[model samples]
Target: MAIQKNVLRVADLPQKKPTQFDIQPEAAQLDQITDQLELSALRKVRFKGVVAPIGQRDWELTAHLGATVVQPCVVTLAPVTTRIEEDISRLYLRELPEISEGSEIEMNTDDTVEALPATLNLDDILIEALALALPLYPKADDAALTQAAFTKPGEKAMTDDDARPFAGLASLRDKLNKDSDGSA
Candidate 1:
């Protein structure tokens, strides 16, 4: 899926100074994005970022991103709205080191570094950031699971003790105590 609504050409980046950009997708774009992400709705999305050149060919992109989204609750299926705000950063490299066939590819743990493409797609980054910020299991404010006694047709309802394997031990102990008291 081509999610590149906003594309910045590599040739347009400033070499000596950082260039800043503000991103706010249109309503249609937002609809497309929500459909792509499987969200119920996307109310708003805003991003402000700077792209600065690092050495000769490397660059870095930093942004403050915010969004309002609605998703279905995991349990009740009600719409759960959420506001997300985060700071995201990515490093662009001109060339990535080659890896051997069998060797493990060790990556940087803190910062994400990727190869610089001909054009940078800010929308793609926005989608990724929003996806990461979303709650894995969302719940509504008043949503809850209710417990009720379950019984089969023409059968009595089972109590909590009926679910335990050792419930009969307590009755046996009580009967033994009563018999010993009577004999004494």
Candidate 2:
């Protein structure tokens, strides 16, 4: 079925019957994730899969979503590649008979409200993608080099500690020595 940019309703979906639907997250959905996730630059991210409408009373819904994400490294501030595979499932119940029958949906006019049906909202699926794509520590290819410099032995390594930051300290020591010996 052709995917839409915003909310999806049972009537809008393509399927043999209203009993089930398959939800696939498209590239357009990534906008929702990048806007809120902050950490994910979202070089390119997309979700693809299906949401099936299933329930004894024909009121239950399940949506499976998968995505691939490319984010930037947090430490080196370089680009990093991340592969994300996820399946998101949501269960839905209708608050009113009209929305349940695919008649119409009403939300708080001023705020963002999550509306569900025997239908899947693309925005929610994007959120699931971001959650799965996130890394505990985002590392670029040069992350290894950054780590090695810090862990190396003291004498052989040139890191923050061994740099010229202390050149002034050495000069101060020399002046103190001269003053104590009356050589100033």
TM-score, per-candidate, Cα-based: 0.76, 0.45
Task: Give a tens-digit lDDT track for model 1, residues 139-172.
Answer: 9999997656788899988877677877888888
Residue-by-residue lDDT tens digits, candidate 2, 90-141: 4444442444566567763532223455555566556754675578677887
Scored by lDDT, model 2 comes in at 0.54
Residue 182, candidate 2: C-alpha displacement in angstroms? 43
Q: Where's the lowest-lDDT run of ten residues in candidate 2?
A: 56-65
For candidate 2, the per-residue lDDT at 120 reads: 57
Per-candidate local distance difference test: 0.89, 0.54
Error of 1 at 11 (Å): 2.7
- Give the clashing residue pairs of candidate 2, or none: 20-53, 21-51, 21-53, 22-51, 23-50, 23-51
* Candidate 2, backbone clash total: 6
